[model samples]
Target: MNSRKKMRGGPKKFKKLELYSRISFLYLNKAFKNPLILKVAERKHKLVFKFLEKEQADVIAKYKNLKEKKHDEVGVRYIWTLWWQGEDLAPEVVKLCLNQLKENSNGAKVVLITKDNYKDYIELPPYILEKREKGYITFQQLSDIIRFTLLEKYGGLWLDSTIYTSKPIPKEYFDYPFFSQHTKWADTCFVQHNLWHGFCIGSKKGGKLVSFAKEMFFDYWENHDVIVDYLMIDYILMIAYNHFNDIKEEIDSLPYSSERLYELVTILNNEYDEKYFNSLMEECIFSKLDWHKEYKLSIKGKETYYSHIVNLQ
Candidate 1:
């Protein structure tokens, strides 16, 4: 009876939310003091300004001020990535971000990471620079890259795109530690092979684990690609969980509900196959029946499978 009580009490006490609260507070405090600045620097060291359109500038400015007052907790470093394509609103966003940061007592570090060639479109202020040059990528791609880079470079707890901010990093977000967390599941999820694609939450040490997992998953896919189809970060973690007892035990102890997936599927469209849907549930440890076809899962099923082979267009 005592053992049963201990087991029951252990998982719930995981304090997923509590961890998120601390991280969120740290993030919010940083935002309050240092809003991110978006700048466009040129190839020849010339800086062009005026990216954010007038309308967007006003809206962002208002948000900056409001956020400052609401999230005055700790100092944080905020950086946002901008593709040369979104040249219109870049300047305005930078100015608004800088203004808010200046108003705070702790002060903030606002920086931009951009590709090298297309620097002439906008003007850059003295504070902004053409730093951290990498190859061209879409907005989504850039966000993922920058998130991981910032985490690696600054040792920040979290990274969010320019479009969003984590006011107080949520405890649930950091619930699992790197190695132990990923290996807790039973299914294989998909993750992009790119730099920022896998394992959203991990420490520097965990980054090494990610590297190992990626290599192993790649090797497995090379030989038995058909068995698993595509490898995702979550699925890779699941595999890792299977191989590592510590991770498996921790994850098994956590509270999970199948209903969450059911809820998610109900809200999405029916672009997925029931078979693939079930596969995802089995792979991701989803306990519910609400699976959606359109949602991105670890494996390519239903819509994805059809879109690839049939050209359903």
Candidate 2:
């Protein structure tokens, strides 16, 4: 098996997509260039709609002029992809998850929220744009804010577009009232550590934990000067862990390549237990494409920040 995430298209050609200065010329979803790893794995579901489609750079470009949408019912089993600023959805990846959902007893719903549709879901203050422009909240920070808001408003799994789902995830993820990967706590000696990861988070709609998260996130957004995106998420989770008697974060279900996992684990201290860590190992099955394994990713155009992710549409 190839250890590296296989891809075609050299970096120079990848930069061509950004040459278009017009908004209409901006590479749309399926129409855009790929990421550092251009090829998506072959497995995919059949149905493709606006929520998940190619040829829709329009979906990502209208970042400032986003509209709002009506809220869905609570407990809807959906996977959200916030492809703001031309982040890679890699059409095949979207298909893989959708197809796998069909394989299940009951398939899940797919939701792709771009900058245009963001305001509809999240009623954030107008100043968020100012924060974005002032550089206080980067697109990354904005993503963190939106993830929490979406998870709170509509219950489901929120996967960073960078994350690719391999097989069907376990039922406990959707069933649990709340769960997220704790990047800070997983390896550290602090068994009592309360760090909570934001990359992959799942929760019940309007759930107390998520509501608390919404509050905590906005509180930090309103007051903080630094870009401690996960810090706000982590800090509030610790507070929630204490306040909510029923909510405790579960193990990370996002998989990683064993080689990469091993490399990461080698540096950690011994306080992590063998059995506990093994449980997490079961779901850590993805091969994370190191963004700069070869040449560094390039950036161009004012339309978005993530022009480097190669596309396969």
Candidate 3:
């Protein structure tokens, strides 16, 4: 039950209104901070305005051309997200997000993973998809499989559809072995793989981390205790990615066993400033470089190259 309690919190599917309102607010706020500013912005905000406009168009183009957007593109510039329910349940806001990711990709391929066609795009054991179709696995589980396949086979970015980007991921980052962060709550080791969450993970396809991650994820899914907590996924990642002889003791020492998550959900729901969202998006655990030496999670220098609107409900 404690394990269940710890695994209770994760980001939810995005809402269309949330994306519409936030991007709108960002542009409107910039364009009209004051009447004089508005006058200045009329001409000055041209670049930013055009960028936003093109972002929307690209998103639409990607959707219309999803069949043509090859996921085989080389390098870390590719972007992938999952929408298990397919386009029918995907909202317009989510479509806009696909564009936002495309915008951030700087011409790299952007692919949205959905249950209907994930097999066509990602390589995995046929049984995994069979399990998904049998209702024996959750979409989250399916997503884990998809991300691992993507990074292992073709290194790139895997971001949850909920994230909205402000800039392209730095090219230098792709040169790294991989990129991931220890979740803020991971200081205590509460949630699971402190290194990788669903937010945004990057790697050079076929890197050691991605390869190990692929096998570790499958190991847990194929032969684990019947307890159905998603935390086990991270737990598997941590163990697989590292060599902790006393892994049990190490995991037990992590501080994730608290009610802080409940408070976070409350704060996100109440519009208590974007700190919550940014923190969730960021590598809050202290580290000088993108990779944390002790926890072994990759940390981005800038906390946010993107934004998330948590209270869209």
Candidate 2, residues 162-204, lDDT tens digits: the string is 4534345666567756665444343221212324445567777
Q: Which stretches of candidate 1 lie over 4 Å from their true place?
A: 1-113, 116-166, 170-176, 179-200, 204-208, 214-231, 249-313
lDDT score of model 2? Answer: 0.46
Query: Could you give candidate 1's per-residue lDDT for residues 123-181 as a string of tens digits?
Result: 33211121112211224433433444444333223322111121222334232333121
Worst 10 residues of 1 by lDDT: 39-48
Tens digits of per-residue lDDT, candidate 3, 1-313, equal 2221111222121133233333433454235344443443333223333422342333323233222122333543667777778656866445545555676676667788886777787677665655667666677777777787888777887777655454565565455455653334322213232434446566676755556557655543443222133433454444433343333332343333222222322232132346554554353221111111122112243222112231221
| Winner of 1 and 2 under TM-score | 2
Using all chains and alpha carbons, the TM-scores for the candidates as numbered come to 0.29, 0.51, 0.52
Which residue runs of candidate 3 sit more than 4 Å off their true CA positions?
1-76, 182-186, 192-196, 223-228, 241-313
How many times do residue backbones clash in model 2?
21
**Runs off by more than 4 Å, candidate 2:** 1-75, 87-106, 182-196, 228-230, 249-292, 295-313
RMSD of each: 23.8, 19.4, 20.6
